[model samples]
Target: MQHVPFPRSVRQKASLAFILVMLLAVGNVSIVQFLLREGDGVAATLNVAGKMRMLSQRMGLSALALHQYPGLPDLAPDQLPTLFDEAHDALRLGGRAFGLDIPAVPKALSPQLLDVRQAWMRQQLAVDALARAPAGDRVAVEALLRANTDLLARTETMMDSLVVQAREVQRRALYGAYALFALDLLLLGLVGWVVSRRILQPVQALARQCRALAVGDYAARSDLPPGDELGELGRALNDSAGRIERLLRDIEQEHAALADAQSMFNGLSDNTVAGIYMVDESLRFIHVNTRMADMLGYPQAVLADGFPLHQVFTGADYETVQAQAMERLSGRATRTRYECVARRGDGEPIELEIFGSLMSLHGRPALIGIMFDITERKRAEASARRAALVYAHTSEGMVVTDADGVIQDVNPAFTAVTGYSADDVVGQTMNVLSSGRHDEDFYRVMWARLQDTGRWSGDIHNRRKSGEEYVERLSINTSYNADGSVNCRIGLFSDVTEKRRREASIWHQAHHDHLTQLPNRQMFEENLRLSIEQARLGGTSFAVIFLDLDLFKDVNDTLGHEAGDQLLRLVGRRLTECVRSSDLVARLGGDEFTLLVRDIEDPDDIFPVADKILDSLSQPFALGQQTVQISASMGAAFHPRDGGSDSELLRAADLAMYAAKEQGRNHFRVYAAEMRESVQVRQGEFARGPDPASAPAQSG
Candidate 1:
């Protein structure tokens, strides 16, 4: 009754061909749209499912917190259920939720989704009951915990099932696309063959008859049947055999115009900066313009003769390039751009950037490619990378600042040395690190020198983030713009605080006594000289006292040198505590010490200092477990009355020391004129035998 529909005329067959093409296009589009929807829907559903699991856990934690601590506010008890319901609806049906376009649950995963929904309902009920329960409600907390655990388990199962179903759908879609493509290709080939036989053959016959008529054989005819468009065309051609000469003249002029257009196109292609070439579906070179031939160090004629692709692209990227060409021919992609390495004619490797597209050339599939040589650009990139590596790893702190000293960038080493991170210092001025140890004049002179010489380097004092002052050896270089104005300043520095500290330590060790940690004779003599100069200039007076421990040698002999050294250290500390901070204390040698008391207003001031020294020395000292009592003989001399110079004052003090020893073992004497005479008078007796009264003796 329907009268099977079949194409019986040329017009019907042509319409059939167009319908097949439209069907193939529509089928491909439908498959693509379905795949995209399936992918997006699976992702959105999985996201919502995962959130439900997390929400279950969150509710349990909040409930536990409320139970453990009384008077605690509920954490999202009211809003959480509402959110859960919305997400649940979005997942079960299809809608936009939580910023995601969710699709309805798949038929295959419907059972798992239903199970999750039921479990979540139970968990929701438990959460509501817990919210109303009192503090320390162990029963309510435990019930919610159990419900949430079950809900979480079901959610995980639903997600697993979702993933499995999504994979299956994608797999089926891929197979369907392959089968559909094969069917479309078969249909296209069959349509083409049918058209060639039913339409092209008739047209060719008409063309031949016309050609015969143009050459004066007017008896020719196409001999085609009537009724369809092709049959009508053949009949018309047979009737117009007499007019073939005029048609032939018009076709010749059209051919001439096409030749001129092609010549102009070739001329522009050869003159372009980029290399232009074309390749057939088999990847054999179909055309090579002059620029392309010159770029590859090959003759255009050689490439156009179908040079092998392997020889043209001799690099590890050959396979990738081949894959791109195949994708283009297979209708997977229409255009592509990529970088690859190629060999020049001299076998030297070069980098190239290529832009390619699929095109029809002479009614056959081909690829048109444009190439640019990027070897120099790649080399410059590598150099920049090496420089960046150095800047990051170098130990020296580096900072770049604008002409006005606003900080722009800093390296990691800068953070290490300054104790300031990039976030703390960037966009700030260099004064952030100022220690305020230098005056404005100091900076003014520094900038003056930099502006004159374009460089400045010195030891600078800077403060750390922790408010500690440190010294750094800093060097700053100035960069100028083309107009000779300052562009930027680059500073490189190293923290030299520890290095300078070590230097000071070495100086102290050289000038101080190692045994007692006091100023040694060298530093003591220097201080005395300095004091003498100050006293003379100010018309003031100072006292010098030379002291000797009476029983020091005996302690050394009885308790060994170690014990004597311990006693000396204790004596030094006590002597320091007894004197003014302005006074100087020194250990001259074994059993001998000196003191310089400056700015004495009256001569009597020296006596109290001498007495305090004697009293401090007389106190009992603990050596190991043994206590020993010792006395000292001290002698004092005044500045102008005793001597005007360091050498004379020291001699007077020495003379008075012996006089104190001659007077008694534990006494201090001011230097009188007779002390020096008394020392001379007893010189022969001190040489003959030691004076028992002044001699060293052990004190119990």
Candidate 2:
């Protein structure tokens, strides 16, 4: 019988246990039966052989007994009942052995067992024959014994064959049992395979979940029917996968948010008002934002892919900016500002102001530049500067100030006129220059006038830091606020301190001949007015004296007007010395001169000065080489006594001088209004002839 390997659980438990019990029962029963059969058969066979041998020996002894006890004759020779009994018993044992061998022996050895049975029978027959024969038949008994021996040999061979056959049969039966065991094991495996289906079902489901996860099927799950640990594990897998799906979704959402933020930052960088650009270590433009692109009239989308920035900036300028940015990065400088011209897309040039700084992007050195158009602002500033320069070089002093009378600005002309540098006066109150020549009340009046009329003009004296004073022709105006408030005051002025001095100089040149450099008659009369002011103020009386150089025109007709003029200068100097420093001297015309004496109170007080002037002219004049003589006729004017004005005084004095000339030459005369009856008028104006003193000189 084949053995089936037992399954550890389920149906195999009871059935295999039962089968094991049954098989063990059967094996024990069969083993006991076989043991008993084999041992009894072997013992019965040995008993049979022993019984046959004993039967033969007994027959021999009986025969020998018959031979030795022939006289007794009680033992039957052919049919001894007792001997048959022993023989029968021996045959019964042999038959029992045959019966045992029939059950225990193999079929292949049945003949050999049958032969042993037949040989035992033949030996029994032989022994019976020997017992029936007479005692003389000893030869027959010997033959029978000999035949039994041969039969025994044949029986031993049969027993040996049966033993070998039985052992061979036992081996075959053992092999059969093992074969049946293999078949039982094969059947159990088939049943086990069917049993494993329930288990493999869950495993297959787990495999599907794993496959789904591998293929990114986050929704896919084992979904195994719930029962045991496998099912719970499947559910856990589904939960884990769900969590992974959520994580993936979260990751995706974060990625999108990051992308959106990056886009926003990019937009701001591109669209900022300030141009932005980045340059790499090679000094090539690495990135350019929209504003930077727009600065050069380029679209960002088209130009963000960098070009060499040096194409726009000369290499020298680029390097300079690079160096400066590097310096700033190294903390070498505070701040640097640069401006340059940049070309547009159309090749037109415009001014740009650039500020560059050092920074790193993506872990590499880069220059960040901010630039803008400064063209208009730069041009306007340049124009304002030119106007300022023009104002600085102007010929007249100018002060520009706000409405508070504070100096906001000044020019070089102001510095020259005021003898102050711009630094000394800027921002100071305009009152810093007030000369105090004008009263505070006057300034109040001026301010009131300006506020009322929006402007005021006057001659004001202002002082300098050096303590020098100057007169300014000042015109000040108030600049108004939009709301009509006074916002600023502007004052412009010219220094006129030298005005009176220049006037006196021109007056001297106009009345006198250029050659003699002395006051002429016109000025002599004008001096009479001043002399009267002196006489009235100082309680002094002064005379107007007129003299003509004698014979002065004759030399001019002979030599030239130049030589005559020279002689006139000589005469003018001689007359000039004859007068006191407080007196006035002038050349009336070509040969005439006038004098006004100051501080003469009495009428006799004038003649001495007149006589001395005449005496000085009587001297000879040395004209280079020729000596010439000249004489003088003098006229005098007295304030209040001669005439009320300079004209009246000159007229009275000239008539008196002509009278003196009529008396004698080289003399002086005192003016008297009573003698004026001899004067004549023509063209309705006084035709006053030569001086009265000179008329007498002409008479002489």
Candidate 3:
């Protein structure tokens, strides 16, 4: 047979082209998004900063104009509007020459800049008042003008600072954009080279490995050959080659080993045992032994029928066996303990058990099957009753009970599980095993489910003869005789008391806060809803108090969050201690916590509890080796008085919570319905009012 190897370079060329195009597109997207877009953003900011600088220059020009045309004493009182108007009109034109938004820029700063402009207005008003006076008193007007000029200089300095900051931001952004563009180009070059290697390198290595295997090299395997189909072929070749090597070595040594091992099977087969003339797998001699030929009644000429195994076993069964063996061969993947069947001369079938693995054989997928006959052993097993003894029975527990729940057959394990033995309660009813906690209803339901479904599975709590209760995972099954009538009832039982206990513990841990082990927000809300229902049913005063750790975020950001969490846990412990054992203390997430103290005497009782909570958190917490002090701000709202509903009461408490935080931290405050107005009033009071149109009219 002749063989031709496939070329790796030709196979990888199309993939290489696709990879190159993707790399180019990626490089272009990186350029447009990171480089050109950033450059555009920097240019936009530069324009804004440039505009601010131009405004600053215009302000300087206005100051220069005031110096050039000073308010003169020589100018007549009636002609003063003309002088002021001329200066203002000329300054407006000069402002437009630059890109200054003169009206808007000064307004954004502190009112001191507007105050300087107002001082100039006051100066003009004084001048008008002096002109109307009996002898034109110009002294007050001169003092006002001098004061206005000093304020204008201060305003100019503030404007200069703003211009400097804007320009600096613009300058940095420009430099960063260019630097980023340069780095982008360098990364794009590196990526292109990487893409080239990624496309070509693997295919070349696969080619080298394939060529290494083609020349009778059995010790070879391939990683992949770029396609799933070809890669699978490569694996099959590797597996087949390995099997062939082992087969050849075994063939060379089989005669010597057979001489040593054949005595174990002497006289096992006779001429009439299988009713077939002697024939080997390849239609050769019956045995690589002399006595086996004597038993099978065959001469050497009769053994060699000169027929291929495939031609002898034809039809569906023939195709099935060959297909299974060839599939294992082609996968270079390994296998062992494989089974297939072959047809006998009398039309009877013989089953074969073969064990082999994949190996490379001159770059071809192949196999070496070692066949054995198991027909006699299989026949004896199927003809008799089947009993499977399972040795690893840790996960499976067995029990044998008679019709009346009497212990008939029991293993030593049953005594260890239920804490009962054969002599202790053998004749007793199943009720003696009950913990007596669940009523007769539980037993009735269990019986009903088993009767309806033929099986029932559930956890059962049972008492031992010594009166100790143990929980068990109980599965009850009803067995039937030949006619499908009931034969016996079997219950598989395993003690799961420890497992149930652990599950309960885990559920409690998840719902409760870790450090305080108090009911968390989720549990608190649930229990609170239940509490509210109880309160409504029985007329009682109850209150929900909300507590917050004051400036906790600042402490966490400045110090570490560990200190913050420790502080929160400490607060939780203190809150629990302060309330009654019957009351609830819950830690909400972060620095917030809540106390549900029911059966209160009055709303006033909440104040003392809130005060205690505040005091408790105010005290230092022992965190690690360090004693760190943090405090709480408490806000409280009462049920029925503050809110009839749970959500309403919580909201009221939360609103008051922000109030406590606002009024310097570390204090308890009761909910005031009008507190919202107070905050709004303060915001309005802090804001500037409209300038009133007043008594004096000034020059333009």
Candidate 4:
């Protein structure tokens, strides 16, 4: 038979079509979601810009009121400046602040926003100058008035330009979305066409051929060209029909041979391997060949003429044998083959395969049978069935390879685990399953150990037919021949990928924070200890910075715990970004985070990192529908200067952090001896009693 190469299997083609349709559908969904998010951000930014226009004029009016009514605290206009600054930041830098959710300004509107910023700065200076001047200073009032006008004009221009740019972006995004939708539709139609032509048509053709074969059309052949699994099924159907036709023809030839056997056996019965016997209608032995006579445990003369068949053939299958003999003599069947137990001359029961045919002797219908003792063959067959059952049903994957590591056979479990059928890996080297994670030396050592001990058991990394690497616990044993030469290698393995993944996940959860996925207090302390040891040995130093987010509790109280958690995660990311890759940042829980800067050559080197952390945290964090601005009160403790051990360094860092909070929030302090003394003095003061005049003010 000629081999016809298929472009792809039916399953692969169908899967490809399904995957293409799914990708298009997902792509459209993703594009829509992305555009909607961007649109939300843009709309929010425009709204904030519109509010800035109003805010510029409102601030000017409030300033004028404050100048006119300095005695009324309600008309102080202090909040106006703060509100104006918040709006300006929201419009220029963009985030959710004061409920004005937005993204940063677009690049096209950056110049306009810079002009507005400059104008706002001049107005801020005038406001400050007016506040410092005497209440009746007309020059101060006039300067403030001029700055407000310029600021208002610039805000309007920036807002107008932003609206134009936002419209253009929205229009382009809409066109792009429309084009993507159209392309998705076209691909879906193409997929449908492929399904019809490549899958449905071949399947229908195969179905028709199957129907023809079912109606006794043994000559039918499915003329499907090989391209997929459907084509392979068609070919298999054709082959089955041909096999049935051949079997029928073989039966006819067997019948012809049976007819000739009746006369041919008379001359050759004594020389044949199997015992031959003739029986009359009365079921008595009419003639027995020499082999048959020996099988009956009698001389040829005693077994001949009137010997009862039951004497040597007495077993549970006697009735079945009698019925089959009758069927043969009645011409119901030209030949009958059956297996039954028969007693040998030694009184031992043995399984026999008997072929019986109808024959004529002295014009009377008789039965002639050729019998063979199949006792050993039956035992071998039963053993083979048991072995095959174990091979097919066992859960562990089993592979048999030649001494040279060429794969010869694989059990069903092997295919289930490795995604490779026996036909796929047979005749291939075991290296086909190599994951390449192990170097050549690894395999060389494995083989060396196996050669020395004739067995190797360990975990091995291998790849599946799908190109996914997995680990398996494998045990391989060498099978040897009688001469002690290696015959084959048998390997049993079970997939351990999931087990390994679960172990890894557990370890990660133990050492990392669940909310931020950052190193937790435990891991951070371990690293700190390690850093201290390394620094002490090398005569180098490292610094530990402890930070507490200011107003973090206020955020939680105002925005809910979920928002607080989001803020913490964002802060973790920003903190990570602030430090070098060699530096370690960890959350010490709640609002506390710690950083370890390694190989600090100077204590002053820690100040820059402290500043960066403060600055990064000062940026606004967008949490769901709200945005929050927060800062960190940080403290730094050097290795030797802040005491040597982990506990000492941590205590120093804690004292300095408290000092930063006492000095005022949103500040950092390096660990100093005076900080501890100050803390102890404050503790003593707290123990005595609260003194309103001298007590340090606390900020949250």
Best by TM-score: 1
lDDT-best of 1 and 2: 1
lDDT of 3 by residue, 325-362 (tens): 55566673455555556565555676655454444446
Off by over 4 Å in 3: 1-413, 427-470, 474-493, 498-502, 514-516, 539-541, 554-559, 679-700
Off by over 4 Å in 1: 1-393, 401-406, 429-471, 475-490, 532-541, 638-641, 672-674, 680-700
lDDT of 1 at 48: 84
lDDT of 2: 0.69
Report backbone clashes per prediction: 0, 22, 13, 1
What candidate 4 gets wrong by more than 4 Å, as runs, is: 1-388, 401-406, 434-462, 468-490, 496-507, 525-543, 580-583, 598-607, 636-649, 667-700
Error in Å for residue 647 of model 2: 3.8
Q: Candidate 2's residue-wise lDDT over 454-513, tens digit each?
A: 898988888977999878788888889899987777777788889845875787677776
Q: Write the per-residue lDDT of candidate 1 for residues 79-192, one digit (tens) a residue.
A: 877777888888878787778889888776778878878998888788778878887687888888888888888989988987887788788878887987898899889789
Clashing pairs in 4: 10-229
Each prediction's TM-score versus the true structure: 0.39, 0.34, 0.33, 0.38
lDDT score for residue 95 of model 1: 85
TM-score of 3: 0.33
- Candidate 1 global TM-score: 0.39
Scanning candidate 2 in windows of ten residues, the lowest lDDT window is 679-688
